[model samples]
Target: MRIDWDVPITMDDGVVLRADIFRPVEPGEYATIMSMGPYAKGLSFQEGYPGNWNRMIEAYPEIAEGTTNKYQNWELVDPEKWVPDGYVCVRIDSRGAGRSHGHLDPFSPRETKDFYECIEWAATQEWSNGRIGLLGISYYAINQWQVAGLRPPHLAAICVWEGSADYYREMSRHGGILCEFLGSWFQRQVVRVQHGTGERGPRSPVTGELAAGPETLSEEELAANRINPGQDILDRPLDGDYYRDRSPDFSKITVPLLSSGNWGGQGLHPRGNLEGYLAVPSEQKWLEMHGDTHFSPFYTDHGIALQKRFFGHFLRDEDTGWTQQPPVELQVRHPGEKFVQRSENEWPLRRTRWTKYYLDPDGQALGTTPSSGADLSYETTGDGLTFLTPPLTDELEITGPVAAHLTLSSDTTDADVFLALRVFDPDGEEVTFIGSNDPSVPVGLGWLRASHRKLDTQRSLPHRPWHSHDEIWPLEPGVPVELDVEIWPTCIVVPAGYRIGLTVRGRDYENEGVMLPGAMYPMKGTGPFLHGNAQDRPAAIFGGVNTLHFTGGVAPYLLLPVIPG
Candidate 1:
């Protein structure tokens, strides 16, 4: 393999972004695989993300097979494995990250335009094919959706693995409630590797040079160079240019797409992947939903194999059996962390039995028929309520999106609703699975702010309620308002004698004794995607008694997509 270190690619604005290109030594021309992100390109995966890397290496020993693993970077394709497979791999340090120098603004239109220029630059290279394919996890994948909307001429395909494309709804805010994930993420992950950290940051194990940059910058200078992502998000409480500028116009994404989501990824990934598949007008697209940690699966044999086949068919025009690929692929989850692979023609499966379980406040149970019951109320800071069904008479499978219809009233002007779907064994022990970040997570999670309950009727579906976060309709205290909450998609197959549960909480859900032991932050049930921002949820306003009223002739109920055998 031939390696080009710190190759300079000038952008349209004369900003020269740096990239490391790995390609076959005797290559004439090959499909180019590229990723540009805030994470330094020179930083080794093991050094940049020690905990995740160590855990992945321990869980899947096969990940260390056949390669040195020294070149691995976070959420990026391993060059050692791909360069030898007749593909050109380019990893760019996006403007103001790593060695590149510019004003750092992630997810900004400027960064996306830079990416467009990089794709064009890679296409004109001596050992590069005119076709460019984008492949990466998280941040890398997020940008692909943005740049693809620009319709770069050389861009041919994209594989968005575990990424959130909708900045406001799926990322910064959930149902108009500000999420702490983006702010925490920008601080812990992005700023740590931002350019100018220099000598203070870790050095690249491969090159023995500063991973951030060559010059150490003062704190004041560093602050002036980049925008505060967290504060920026908090400032824009209502969705407008702030988020619309960062998010992709899905309809403009016409490139071949392979969107892979993690079913257990409660907060971030699931919505975007499913939305991309359903919204993108791409003539050729596939959606694959799986179960596992965020970083591990991207490096495993299964992930690489699927990527190769997809890129092989689209980029190289080689028959890698992708011609027989189905429109939707699901790793159907079962009890005991088991996943069974299955394929279908479309998402939410056309044959799904859309079942509704009425919420009986009096019994604190879910039943087939709507029951006239008393209203249920709880402290805004407490575990609101848990409604469950009796043991199933036979095995039941719920394999798609879920929704909840409820009539709510709060003492304050607003209320934050946190929903958790869970499954329990015959003995009543709660069954949990390994999530993208958290070790144990519920079957499905959803959130809503009563003030943002106004729906985008045109975009809303029975199973998925799309909220127009553009405006807020403050709650009239003590007055009932109907809310249709859209839970992220999930897959679970419960056996007979097992009960299905739903816990509606006033705050982030937490497992009694579960915590991601080496994670940068405490990842309870909902990972780091907590929504307890003081400014957004001031105690004086959000801290109050919340009620679930079963009235207006429409009893509250849970809408589930049950797939028939």
Candidate 2:
């Protein structure tokens, strides 16, 4: 293997971005897998994301079975692993990051253009055969959608591993509430290593060189050289031109794609992968969903083999049997924490029996029969209400998007509703799964701001209703308003004795149950996907009494996509 460090790739505007290319020593032309992102290309996985690295190696020992993992970058393929497999792996420091020259900006129209240029530039390189595939997780995967929208000729395929496609819905705002992640993440992770931060940032352990840049810049200059992404997100609370420009136009992404998502990543990961697979005009596309730490499964033997097969058929034109692969692969989850791998022709399998479990105020239990016209109210600032199903009489499989219909009133002008689809074991203990960032998370989650209840009827369906965040109508203080809250998809197989549970909360969902030990980082309620930003939901406004009214005419129910056995 030969690695060309700091290889220069000049963009259309003549600004050169630095890349590290790893290709076979005797390489002729080979299909290339590329990743470009803000997380410095030279930063080691162990240093940039220690918790993920440690969890990854522990769960998938085979990831480091042979190679030294010396070239491992966050959410990217190990060059040593892929280069030896007869493919070239390229990592580039995107403009404004690492050694690249430009103002530090992320997910902007400019960044997408830069990515397209990089793909074309690599196609013409000595170690390339004109075919290029984008690969990586989150940041790396997010840009793949953006660049593919440009329809670059050489962009042959893409493996989007747990990435968000909608910059507004999936990332910045969940339902219509503001998520604090994008803001907090920028301040902590990207600011210091931004382009001009230079020598002020950490040095590379491998090359013993400055990770940001070769030349240092003054504090004032460094601050001015980068965009304040978080603040910009805060300023634009509504989903409009700002997010649309950063998001992908799926109609134009026709390249073959392998989109993978995690069931636990409610705030961002799941929505994008599913939407990308279904919306993109790509004729050759596959969707796979798994349950585990975000980065863990990507490096597992299972992940590598799947990736190789997809790229093999598309990039190398090899008969790797990827052509016959099912359109959707799911890891059917079980309460005791087990996975049953199943393949099907499409997402929301045609055989899915959409079941509605009606809310009965008495005992706060779930049943099919309409409830006695009972009214239930919980303080908007409290734990809210919980409804449970009797232990299943038989094994039940709920395996698609979950939605809720509630008729409610708020004492104030608006209310926030949180829905948690959870499972409980035979021992009566809550069942939790590994999330993108949250280790202890319930099976499924949904959130909706009462005022943002306006639905797009043309795009609306019983299974999933698209909410047009274009308008907001506050609740007539104390008047009943019906809402359709669409919970992100989840897959779970409940045993005969276990039970399914629903918790309606005024705030983010949190498992008051025992937490995992030795957690590297603090993951609060709803994990990092929280949306309790004060600017969006001020206590003065939303902190009021909330009510759930149940009756035959206005029954509140949980609609689950149940796949029959």
Maximum-lDDT candidate:
1
* Clashes per candidate, residues 3 or more apart or on different chains: 0, 0
Over 1-73, each residue of candidate 2 has an lDDT whose tens digit, in order, gives 8988999988888888999899999959999999898888777888877766776788778888889888888
lDDT of each: 0.90, 0.86
Candidates in order, TM-scores: namely 0.98, 0.97
lDDT string for model 1 (75-158, tens) is 999988998889999999999999999988999999999999999989998888799999999899899999999999999999
What TM-score would candidate 1 get against the native?
A: 0.98
Clashes of 2: 0
> How many Å off is the CA of 425 in candidate 1?
1.3
Candidate 2 similarity to native, TM-score: 0.97
Error of 2 at 474 (Å): 1.1
Model 2 sits at a Cα RMSD from the real structure of 1.6
Pairs with steric clashes in candidate 1: none
Off by over 4 Å in 2: 513-521
